[model samples]
Target: MILILVKLFQGLYVSNSGEPWVEEAELIRRAQAGDPAAFDLLVERITPYLYRVVRRLASDQNEAGAIVQEAWLRAWRARHRYVADRPLSPWLVRIAVNVARDLWRKKAPLDFADLGGEEIVLPDPVPGPEDQLTRKEALERLVRGVKKLRPEYRMVIALRYDAGLSYKDIASALEIPLNTVRTHLRRAKSVLRLWMEAEDG
Candidate 1:
């Protein structure tokens, strides 16, 4: 929200072409004035991370998608209420998590096996003779490592690494305090590091 990263670039006058280019102020102004494109850009910029958070929180794929879609619609409908000066991702994710939580609450109770499931079982598919072995091996290892993690740790790692969010940003987006973010990262890294070491051994 404070644009601290941009402050350093201001001195060098270097611009980021790859970073989110939508001007926050301009987007807010347009959205407030009922411009649809501005609202669309806001959704586009935030959807990936918001989806990831919802997927982590939701009980299944359908619920995750539903929550994300509901959150976006609600956000768009309530766009005028959003403070232009605030960070959008946190605001958006807050809406998403709340939606997911509400959905979760409405569901019937589940068995422990359904909630805290064990490692996923996948069929050993037969590959063609010409299949790329190296890529397959690498992917298998990545999946194994991820599957070994606790769901909570896995969600933190996915949100931070796969979603490319900073520690502070993740903390805000997930609605957790800064120390909890650091704790989750620490635990996730430690788990991954141990898994890698064991694989090497």
Candidate 2:
């Protein structure tokens, strides 16, 4: 899967460290071939973003950290299944999202009321705690409403909206048909819109 999961990501694999964009295809190829250094290189590039993504899905910071580590472990273990031409971040994210979902499912279906806690990194670039606090309370209702969706729906939301991945990228990450990604996005948007409107009322 194409791994350009987040729009605001900081890439360690970029030709220039401070450069936002990176060409990771070769790096992905090497990593897929069981090169530990390659894999480490790839992981180092994505670790912070990976943790943030999991932090949004999981309950607490600690759980998020654990989920991030497990995600890399799972990704490495399943490296043979990777499609190198595709972006690696999405695949890594899919694993992390599923891992978080599985854990959440084991405890409980993620409920609307339970969506609030520490502020999750959203698509927008909020500066810090001061910037986040205002949005946090306002967004909690939106997030909780989103949590009311099916896991599949939420998956799309996280990947497409939160991670800022494209529909094609999401399909690759989810390993589903491209049409399925379209359908999921359509349906999830419809559901979320309706849910949000209701919340507004």
Q: Return the lDDT, model 2, position 16.
A: 35
TM-score of each: 0.54, 0.60
102-160, model 2: which lDDT tens digit per residue? 77777756343222222233346488887788578658866775667766667777777
Could you tell me the lDDT of residue 165 within candidate 2? 86
Off by over 4 Å in 1: 1-24, 44-49, 52-61, 104-151, 189-201
Please, what is the whole-model Cα lDDT of each candidate in the order they appear? 0.63, 0.68
Which whole-number lDDT from 0 to 100 does residue 6 have in model 2? Answer: 27
Angstrom error of the Cα, residue 28, model 1: value is 2.6
lDDT of 1 by residue, 66-180 (tens): 7778887788788888887887776777677567656656765432121221232333546664355645764577556765555556556666765667888777766788888
User: Judged by TM-score, which candidate is best?
Assistant: 2
C-alpha lDDT of residue 89 in model 1: 73
- Measured over all alpha carbons after superposition, the RMSD of each candidate to the real structure, in angstroms, is 11.4, 8.3
